[model samples]
Target: MSQTPLLPSRREFIKQGAAAAATFMIVPRFVLGGKGYTAPSDQLVIAGVGVGGKGESDLASFAKTGKVRIGYLCDVDDRRAAKSRQAFPQAKYYKDWRQLLDKESKNFDAVSVATPDHNHAAVTLAAMQLGKHVYVQKPLTHDLYEARALTEAAKRYPVVTQMGNQGASGDGVRQLQEWYDANLIGKVHTVYCWTDRPVWPQGIPWPTGATSVPPELDWDLWLGTAPFRPYVDKLVPFNWRGWWEYGTGALGDMGCHLLEAPFRVLGLQYASTVQASVGSVYVDEFKRGYFPESCPPSSHVTLTFPATKKNKQEVTVHWMDGGIQPERPEELGPNELFGDGGNGILFVGKKGKMMASTYAANPRLLPLSHNQEVKVKPTLARVPGGAEGHYAQWVEACIAGHGNHTVSAPFETAGPLTEALLMANLAIRGYDLRRPKTTGPGFDYPGRGIELVWDPQQLRVTNFEEVNRFVKRDYRPGWQ
Candidate 1:
């Protein structure tokens, strides 16, 4: 099928006309012509779908790349998306992302997907299939199926793809990755990652309002492939991250960032088997529909990794959210102690331990201390400017295909990482889960936790038959 064509709006035309007038009216001698110089060969056009919130920041950075031009802007909520148009007045705006792709396909060489988790795969898949490079926000997919699908599609398309785990490129992250490689943290067996997210619009009760939809919001488009539901303001613009239908709750929201370091350093993929344990502080929160009743409040999710060909030892990566953290590692020092609402990832190897945040700028590394002493090294390996540099690297790759670190979290690597986290998510949806066996390729539930052997091919639990329904979603009529 032919892709959508760009429809130039009257506002956009006027904006462009004004820009032309300014460019002509302003004299170059006084305006500093050097800064606005455009390379003759540099012409990589890009579009941002969902250009508000974080998307706004992404658009600004991409615009600074100089080699790329922001050609299209898309968002379902027109009111919220207004700032995007003002930020990049030259770019065209669209209420429906599909229409942006269909009409403006040829206008952009690549597409940046900054939509909610539910719409990531649909928009990314459509753009990638049409031979457009995609920079999708993490976690890459809404479900295990979408993760695998995105992985396959990436292989099929010859395009430069990157997941927006910006910290993956940070100096601290790279240093952490290097430490793992050098065996500074030897034979890493366990990892603890946490984040205090949904910090913005979290703990929202189930939305109860009139069925009437807002004039500015294309309710159906916003819902995208998720199930049909009445219009609710709580789910629009930004709050969707706390809901099951729109977002992946806290796990899906921050897992990619918290786990990126471990996954990248260890090349971790989907868990061999997965299980989760839930601890609810308030029962009424679940009953009264405070927060997404479908998701858990506080939970401990454990993923067991099988022995790989290279690293012939299995590993376990644990995830904690909603103010839960792992038992403080014995190596952490008095000053190095993590505080409340801390976001960091710990890489505990047989030798040493290291932990860092999303930016990975200031990592706390522990020496080989038996008594669990926190010793901050005076000088450590430095990672130059992390994601800021990574962004530039991608732009260079997109244009010249020449850069030192070109493997910027492409789908091949991102898919497995996303799938692993999704497994944790599935474990949550599978009711109260239990820990897997201390040893084995399968999961073992103790008392309350349910043991569900994951089948990657079928995308379901082998023994627990009920989870198959949550494997994928049925989109609304027109959306599908």
Candidate 2:
């Protein structure tokens, strides 16, 4: 069977539009003249999917670069898209991304996807299939399979791709890398990443009843690839991060930002095994609540990675959320802040320790003074504007085309990093697995107290088959 082509071959399309293409092939105005003389046609045309909140800010940042033009804006909710619409008044608008891509693929050179976790894969895959460079929000996709798929697709599609974990472009992570390379911290063997996330509700039952769908919101389109359900209040915008069908829990929300540092500095890849323990919610004085549809209130997950060239010993990475924190390093003053108070990443090495705040910002060697005392020559090339430079980096890379430039968190790196976080989620989800008891109405929690052995090649929990359902989720009928 032959697969239907998503878009006409690039070669054929260019050949068919030879006359029109020749007009755009002229030398850039900047090269012909001087600074501030770039041709309008030379600007990178972008289409933003989910242009609201963070998406709006992302698009705005790209436009601020003066080298990018927001050519299209798309979102399921008009209320959310309104600001971006006003901000980029010249851009065309669409509520459905599919329609936008189908009709405007030629009008835009790239697409920015900032949708909820579950819908990320479908939209990104479609965009890549059409040969559009993509900048997707962090935790790249909702499920393990999607992350892996997007990673592999980046190679096959011949397009520049970046995950929105902007910290990957920050200087702090590079400083950590340089320090580690210089043996400031001798052979890191353990890493702890913690956050106070899920500021929204989790570990609770879904809202009791559906609310009337808002006139400005298209609930069906908003649901996208997830299973259909009546619209509920407060699920849009941000609260959706706490739901399993829509979000990836706290890990999905913050792991990419917190975990990217260790993964990069330590040369970590997929985890060999993962185990987790999650906090439960109590519905009453004597009874604990069981909300299988929602994420836990808190979780502590430990993932073990195989030995890599950077670290000869197996590495253990710990993730905690919902306000849980690791022990304060003894080398620090008692009054010093630990991980910016609410979130942080810590690396424990044989010789010393180091920590940083969210987005790998404000990195410091243990004892504070070491950060100022130790001088290691900078080795990694710094991104122009550091974390903020992440946007321009993508823009320039897109202009350069695929295989010609490097991005901070390309899918090749993000896929495995995201999968590691999602794998921890698999353990978290598996820890809550319940089955009806053979002889009674009660349930048995069978997945608890087990270390899930992972087979990266197979993308499954080899030791716990039942928990593998999360590896690949089922999209709704039309979505697939």
Clashes of each: 13, 0
Tens digit of lDDT per residue, candidate 2, span 275-376?
Answer: 999999889999999998999999999999998999888899999999999998888888999989999999999998999999999999999998779899
Candidate 2 TM-score, true structure as reference: 0.93
Please list all clashing residue pairs in model 2, or write none if there are none: none
Best by TM-score: 2
lDDT of 1 by residue, 1-480 (tens): 112211224564454334223322334342354666655334677888988888888877887867678888888888877888997788888888888877877566778889889889888877765667788888898877788878877765566788888877777676666556656667778888886665645444575767677888888788889877778755667677767777887888888888887776677766778788765545364553323244666677888887664345788888888778887776665666562237777777777777777545566676435225533342444424566766666666666431334655888889988988888888777763335578886554442456668877666778776566567776667774
Q: Provide the TM-score for each candidate, comma-separated.
A: 0.81, 0.93
Model 2 Cα RMSD, 1 decimal:
3.5
For model 1, state the Cα shift of residue 83 in Å.
1.6
